[model samples]
Target: MVGAGALIGLAVEFHALGWSSIPGNSCGGRYRPCPEGTTPTLILAFVFTFAGFTGLTVALAAFRRIRPGKALPGALAAAGVLIALWPGWQAHLWLRGPVLDPAWQASPDRPASVRGVGVWALGDGAGTVVRARTDALIAYDSATGDRGWVLRAPARESVCAMSERPVDGIGLVAFARDEEPCDTVWGVEVSSGRTVWERDFAGRTLLYGGGGVLSADGGVAVALGERSVHGYGLTDGAVRWTAKPTAARAEGGDDAECEPVTASSAGGTTRVVVTCGRYTDFHSAWLLTLDDATGKEPSRRELPVESWVNAAAVLSAEPFTLLVQEKDERGLAAVLAYAEPDDPERRPVTIPLTADEEDLALTGLHPVFTARPVFRAQVADGNLIVAAARPGSDDAERVAAYSLDDGRRRWHADLGTPVVALAPAGPGRVAVLGESQRLWTLTTGEGTRVGEEDGTTVRDIAFKIDDGPQLVRAGDGWVIVNADGDTYAPALAVRP
Candidate 1:
């Protein structure tokens, strides 16, 4: 009886994981195909099912040979009867087709003819904010929404690029201006809106992920390209360090490239982690740590990665770890965390997601999970926030927050939509962006949605993928960007 119960429980768990050997539906939904092949759930399910069948067959044979009775035959007959009628009584409800919300019309008060804007809430005591556009870098007073200063870049270069976004620190903002042949990164003063320094790079500059592009101590800003990682001084914008993956160059051949995942500098050490290889072939990731003062490599650690892992990023730099999101062979979406690049212990902690929860998350949202990997991991209120679905029927999806230190679940919010983004709002509060154009205020302490709002809508099918308004923290309030890369301060009033 115990063994049977265990087998049944295992089956139920595998079903909850949403893994299948059904070819294209390994993630097991009608929405989209997962990039992976077979899943661990399917493997375990086959084991359990085969074991149960063997046990039953042996039991029946023993009973027939030793003490043949009607009991064994009657039991088999009853099981067959139940199995035959099980599907007849079951009912399934198909969901409604997703409807497109109205395209967000920017307010007239917003900057007109805006090509692109990078909004940063310079939350220092001065209550100053910065916005970078194609032609100008404008600073604003957060108190009255008054424009402060505008420093325009030279006409030979553009202020923003289609791929890279600007990032801000205490009183400085860093951005990459795409020139004719190469891109240059400029660090400007937020108060005066003056260019402090500029450094040229071989390719596009790196944008900040969960851990911002700047180091923790604000000494160096890290930029990543297809083949190399360039570190620049935060104050002077001088090239501090340049690292190319030795393993990738040695093993990946001419076609393989080194992709820098994430970087952080603390306690006079700057660590940059990069994954090297061709996605269609085998690859590995390595962590490179250097002395910030001299740009010397003191330690290098090779990270263990699955052959299927195509992308990774640093969640928090204090411990210096990487987060990976990919589908397994059976197509089940998986989120995993690895130790610091220097550590050899590569066992990853798998973040859990349920089939029902995934359904809620993908509803009204684009089904391209593999295209957006960094969105899978977030850090809010010192806790790591992961968008995972729990096993349930009523679409009770949750944004689970785990401890940054121990990976223990700290809190979770049962928002109906999948959490697409998490931004720090205020003390103990987080701004959760649902897959749909909805924003909810979640208190990290209790995992409760204390505030909610219908955010910007999208009418065009093209707008449904990739480009969405980003949520930013301005002092104690919020700032949002729309699909057109225009900044709107009106959404700042969102509060629980």
Candidate 2:
């Protein structure tokens, strides 16, 4: 029986460690069933725990058959061993130590006169690039903190918004100016500090309103006054096409009151989704899809109007366009998947927060979304991971994972900080940046403290550079962008 219990314990440990097998299982019975790859691990854990319990029963039966004096000592010893091993089993299944290498030193000569808004680790994670808001546009080397090149804007209007991503072997920098009648479009080469092309639209008002710069397949799109949306060629910034609004404006209504909320490009097309309202409180929203090649309006769909429509990340290409909208109530987030025009299917999922949860904000850089209380919640891999600090306490934060499909709580762990940033690293792992300047690499079921560095206060952090939770990578290390325009990359204690 003792041997059987030991074997069961070993099996449970293996399964819990992601080694054993189960079948078509959904975690905690939320969402859909688990993927086929997860079945083996689940079965192994169940069998091992059941076997251990059976062995305990058999050992108790043997104790009953023995004399009272001998039976008492034997039972006590078995119970003591079991008690000691149980917590150890849990510890082995969860806790991992901080991992770090001390040989690496911080890089010098970080970019000056800049504030990092976004960080991108490009090409095999060897080259780390950061987009900072300076008097000009600059890309800094993540490893050595060397400034690569700086491209100055045509006119000295503050960079109201900027988006940076690698496109066609060059870092594309898109900026919009709050000032009018000037060139708002600029592209800079990261390898060589040169402006490849610049275009000025005299009458076009590039909305500084929130949303992505509509660019894809080497092209850029911008909404002019309420009447038209224009697409430009990437090579020389030539106008490709201009799309007009589908609905005519009502007379006597103020035209300037209407504005676009978000614009996105995908599948060789650029789309402008706008929310407009009058001062009297009547509001309407529309989704307008434009062809990048011709700049013609292909389809337009009117959507239900909310007080505000927060743009979530783009999901998949087929079936529908998935977006999350936060309602006015605290702690409520809605996921809406809309089919293209002429398709009849719509999937809307409303995810409610825990009763005690509050102050949730989604990270802009990473694919995952986060909500904060004293405890925080992250959405990834079709699951929600919630981390909550204990009541009236601030030392350690406890985390719980739930399957997004079925809303089942999977597992929980304690992380040692108040999380300020939560970004997705890979499938089930998350890179958590804390207000304490500590970085923790965490998975749905596991976590470890990886490294720490001094960080500026929350108020000093700038959101203009797109360098928040979405940009940092836990597998490589925590990249710090200081207030003085210096970007620092420190090696994380945990490896990929």
Candidate 3:
């Protein structure tokens, strides 16, 4: 009975993981072909796993060929070991990392004038691919090339920027009114294209871009106004908390000079970065962390240098890091890391993103001017992983990892070709797609190849693949989204 239950559980797990070697499997009610597998090896593994522990033990005990106590102990140990190691074996031997042959392709269905700036795959099941254009946000079914929904900007208005990511299935967006930069915020549901709520900040306060949110729990929609930070309800857009710098200023310099520029949030804390100095050229900045529920300031830290020519951006809020820019809009200057979050005593360590070696210019970051904070580099595996380009070029040709503790270059892998984008994959690993239509995975710490031997390359595609694409794991496969301001490239492609 124990052996049978274990076998049944293993089968269920394999089915749940989409490892079943069936061609016409019901893949989200769409015609996605089941992934190719090692059928012969799978059969051998199954037979050995079952008979080695269960069948052999039964035969040995029933025929009195061996003692029941010894046979039973050996059988249980073998079964436990096999069950524990099963998942890893399947991940390595059966799945064999990512395959580039897409089950379906979604090309750019817009006019020649329309250009895509970003693409995101939201949700886990079945999944939907969202393409962000200057005009509207379009959702497409990943399994089939059908339109899920369209959330267009108001008449005479256009989409200016979007939130860093969708939170609790709601993606916050910013739109410009006529000639304005970004004056309104809208929360749109990811699965359904319903606008849950909208807030227009025109006459009341100044607006820059999208809402900064921590999580979905008792959610708060936080935004950085001209000089203050406002937290609204995530679902209803109701004002929950608001913190003005003058009222909550620390025992430091003048609070009048501090102007909120950009903000990001993670783990129930919203961090707002404000530049403080004269109007012409700011000298310093302050990073204030506010609780999501109450607008209470928990931790406040001072940044050394910030000016009109040199600016700072909140890169990742979870780990709490900042990117200082050389030019106002473009060029890498340095990266600052907060060793701890919400710890008042913690000081930031400044790390340079661009090295003098000319081999590590970051190409994965959004220009420093956008209202939306969409930083492509990620903090994973105890290091900051960033896509790099050679000096004097903008294409990402290498990936490098720097130590988060002391800001030292640990390792860098020369991809030989430009990379598409970086996406968080399994633990300690980030998925990388080559501009040549191939996919691979690398360990963020050691920068070792954990994917295929030579990586999986997708062939026979009829669309233009750009250098900046997001690699997303949607449902049973992967989705390659092209949003790098390419006017001619396909919006996205789905891997089976």
Which candidate wins on TM-score? 3
Residue-wise lDDT of candidate 2 within 67-110, one digit each (tens)? 44555645564555465456545544333223222212233323
- For model 1 the TM-score comes to 0.56
- What shift in Å separates residue 483 of candidate 3 from its native position after superposition? 2.9
User: Which candidate, 1 or 3, would have the higher TM-score against the true structure?
Assistant: 3
For model 1, how does the per-residue alpha-carbon lDDT over 211-249 read when each residue is reduced to its tens digit?
223342447666554467667777677777776655635
Candidates arranged by lDDT, highest first: 3, 1, 2
Which ranges in model 3 have alpha carbons more than 4 Å from their true place? 1-99, 202-218, 246-254, 281-283, 309-311, 326-332, 357-359, 363-376, 390-395, 461-463, 484-490
What are the lDDT figures for the candidates, one per model? Answer: 0.49, 0.45, 0.62
TM-score of each: 0.56, 0.57, 0.71
List pairs with backbone clashes in candidate 1. Answer: 37-329, 37-330, 38-329, 38-330, 39-330, 103-459
What does the lDDT come to for candidate 3?
0.62
lDDT of 3 by residue, 317-405 (tens): 66777776544444446888887855657766667766664444442234322334344577886688877877777677788888778
